[model samples]
Each structure stands twice: as C-alpha cells, then as structure tokens.
Target: MKRILIIATDGFEQSELEQPKKLLEEAGAETVVASLETGTIKGWEDGDWGSDVQVETTVDKVSADDFDGLLLPGGQINPDVLRLNDTVIDLIKSFDKQDKPIAAICHAPWLLIEAGLVDGKVVTAWPSVRTDLKNAGGDVIDRKVAVDGNLITSRNPDDIPAFTEALIDAVKIPAENVVEHI
Candidate 1:
C-alpha cells in the first residue's frame, strides 16, 4: 500500500484534511499526519475552531523517502504559521526533490512559496494568496483543482472532491513506461 504524509499544524481546514484523508484511507493508502509537533492539532471549519486531528509524526521524525506523497491542508492560520518554520519548509523541499506527489489546498500553498517550489508551476490557492503566489513565480488559476507535474493544488474546501480525485489518481497512475499525466 502507498503511504501519504500530511503536513499540517493547528488551524487546518477541517474538510480539506479530513475528507481527503477519509478517501485515501478507504483506498488503502496509509496516511500519516505529520505536524510541527506530536499530540492533537485543531481544525478550522467555516471560520471557527472545528475538531482536532491527532498528529502521528512530528516533522523532525519523518523521512521523505518513506512516503509516496505529501498533502497540505490549508486554513488561514494553518499555513501562515507553517510558512514561518524553517524545518517544515525544508521538509516540503525534500518532498519536491524526490518528485513525490505534493498536494496543497486553500492557504496551504503559502508553504510552497516559502519552500521555493512554486516557480514555473501551475497551481491554485485561496484567492487571497493569488498575488503572493504570482510573486513567487507560479501560474495562478481559479480552478477547483490544478495538477502540474507532481503537484496538486485546490482553491478551497468546496474543491475537495476534485482535489481528492486528483490525489487518488496521482498515486494510482501505474509506474511504468506509460507517460500518463495528471
């Protein structure tokens, strides 16, 4: 089974993280919630504190080689705080170096910018961050989901369906001579 690493901190968008996690888990992928620290992380739902998701592994304890993909669930405060962490940014860079699938939603793409992985890539994020993303050299769009190379991005919670589907396809694409692009 493929393993996916979800890097998040407190204030993650509840649906963006929980929905895809449920889908990935049902598809038989092992999902690890990697946070800045262990214990429980809070979620943001409809502009309020939602639920809590347990952190399975801290960022310092995770190795990029052990996972098949990375996920970033966004919330206003979630990615804001994450972008300030050097270690978290380094981890994001490590996943990019490995060419592993990395998905970011809502404000989560902020970390992508901080990690220096947005240049020349097509992605979509919460409208509020469009300027920041463009300044970082990314082609920004308003689509529900955008898939470029090994990166998957979505605009918001409403886009979770397409976002989840894109991620599922990312892992399901047979690793062969086949050049199927997502």
Candidate 2:
C-alpha cells in the first residue's frame, strides 16, 4: 500500500487534519502522523483547544522516502511551532528535494516558507498568510485548492474535501491502473 505522512504539531486546525486523514484512508492510502514529539497533539477549534490526535512518529525519526506524499495541517499555532524546529524544517526540505507530493492547508504553508520551498510556486493558504507567502516569492491565490508541481495547498477547513481529493489525485494512480498492478 502507498503510505502518506502528515506533519503536524499542537494546535492544528481540527477539521483540517481529521477530514483529510479520513478521506485519504478511505482512498486506500496508509497514513502516518509525524510531529515534533510523540504521543498526542492537541488541536484548535474555533478559539480554543480542540481534540487530540495521536502522533506516531517524530520528525527526527522519519525519512521522506518512507512516504509517497506529505500532509501539513494548518492552524496559527501549529505551523508556527513547527516552523521554528530545525529538524522539522529539514524534513520539509528533504521531502521537497525528493519531489514527493506535499499538501499544506491553512497556515500550514507557513512551514513551506520556512523550509524555503515557496519560491515561484502558486499556493493558497489562510488569508492571514498571504503577505508572508508573497514575501517569500510564492504566487499566492485565494482558491479552494492549488497544485504546483508536487505541492498542494488549500485555503481553509472548508476546502478539506477538495484538498484531500487533490492530494489523492496527485499521488495515486488511476483506479483502473492500480487494479492492473494488483
């Protein structure tokens, strides 16, 4: 089975992480949650701490080759905390260097900027990060989903369905083709 990695930290937007994880699993991808620390990470919903999602691996223990795709869930605090971790930033850069499909939602794209992967890429993220994206040389958009090369991004939790679909499409072979391989 193809494997996907989700990089998140405490305060990730609840829906942005849960919804896509469900969709990706139903699409036949094995997903692993990687974070700065092990155990669980708390999410943010509305203006407060939300549910907790289990983290299976730490950034220092994961390798880009182990995953066919990467997902970055966004919340102001989530990506902010992640972007400051040097190992986390290196992992992002490693994935980009391998040209693997990567999806970032909401403020998750901030991690991309910190990893120096935003240059010349067309991306969409939370409205608050528009200027930061632009300042980092990204062609910012306000779309529901945006795909540039191997990078995928969505505006907010409302766009999770589309974002998940785009992510599956980017890394998965057509169903007919997959059956043939099987």
Candidate 3:
C-alpha cells in the first residue's frame, strides 16, 4: 500500500486538505497527517475558522523515507507560518532529495520555495503566489496541475481533483520512473 504524509497546521484551507485526503483514501492510499503540534489543528473555510482535524504525529517525528509521497495543503496562513519553520523546510527538502512525489497546492508552493526546490521547475500556485514562484526560479504557469520531476503543484482548491490524481499516479510509479509517468 502507498503511504502518503500530509503536512498541515492551523489555518489550512479546509477543502484543500479534506477533499484530497478523502479522495486519496478512497483510492486505496494510506495517509497520515503530521503537524507542528500533537493535538488538533483548525482549518480555514470561506473566510472563517473551520473544522479541526486530529494531528496523527508531529512533523519532526517522521521521515521522508517512510512515505511514498508528501501532500501539502495550503491556506495563506498555513504556508506562511510553516515556511518560517526550519524543521518543516528540512522535511520538504528530504522528500525532494529522495525523489519522492511532493504534491503542493495553492499557497503550499510557498513551502516549496522555502525548501529551495523550485529552481528551474515547472509549477503553479494560487495567483498571488505566481510572482514568488517565478522569483524562486520556478517556471510558473497558470495550469490546474503542473508536474515537474517529482514535484506536483496546482493552483488552488478548485484544482484539487487534478492535483490529487497526479499525486496518486506519481505514488503508484517507482521513484525512478516517476518523471516518465508524469
């Protein structure tokens, strides 16, 4: 079975995290939510504080080697706060270094930029983030889903379906053959 590590924290976009996670589970992939804290993290939905999701583990307690892919759910506050965290950045870098599928949507790409994984990579993110992606040396596009190497990115919650599909496909492929499949 494929194991996917989902990284999120307070203010994560509710649908962005919940929808894809539900879809991934229905697709037969096991997912674990890791956060900066051990309790529940609140989500943001429709301009207000949304539901809470239980945190399965803390980010520092997990390793990239143990998961087939990484899923980063984005909300302006979630990625903004997480990008400032060194441990979170290092974990993202480890996933990239190991050539594992690192799927990030919406503002989540901000974390990718922090991890220094955007250089020369084709990616997409919420409109407000395109400039940052470009500045980080990423080939920013307006597509719903952009797959470069083992990196999978999407523009926003509206793109979650395609985004999740890409991640699942990438997870099912062997590391060495990921690029070819994309």
Q: lDDT tens digits, residues 1-182, model 2?
A: 77899999899999989988877877788899999888999999999999999999999999998989899999999999999999988988888999999899999999999999999999999999989999999999999999999999999988988888888888973564331110
Error of 3 at 102 (Å): 0.4
lDDT of 1 at 180: 23
State each model's CA lDDT, in order. 0.88, 0.89, 0.93
Which prediction has more favorable TM-score, 1 or 3? 3
Q: What is the TM-score of each candidate against the true structure?
A: 0.93, 0.94, 0.94
Per-residue accuracy of model 3 over 30-53 as CA lDDT, tens digit each: 899999999999999999999999
Clashing pairs in 2: none
Worst 10 residues of 3 by lDDT: 173-182
Best-to-worst order by lDDT is 3, 2, 1
Instruction: Name the better of 1 and 2 by TM-score.
Output: 2
134 in model 2: Cα distance from truth in Å?
0.6
Point out where model 3 deviates above 4 Å.
173-182
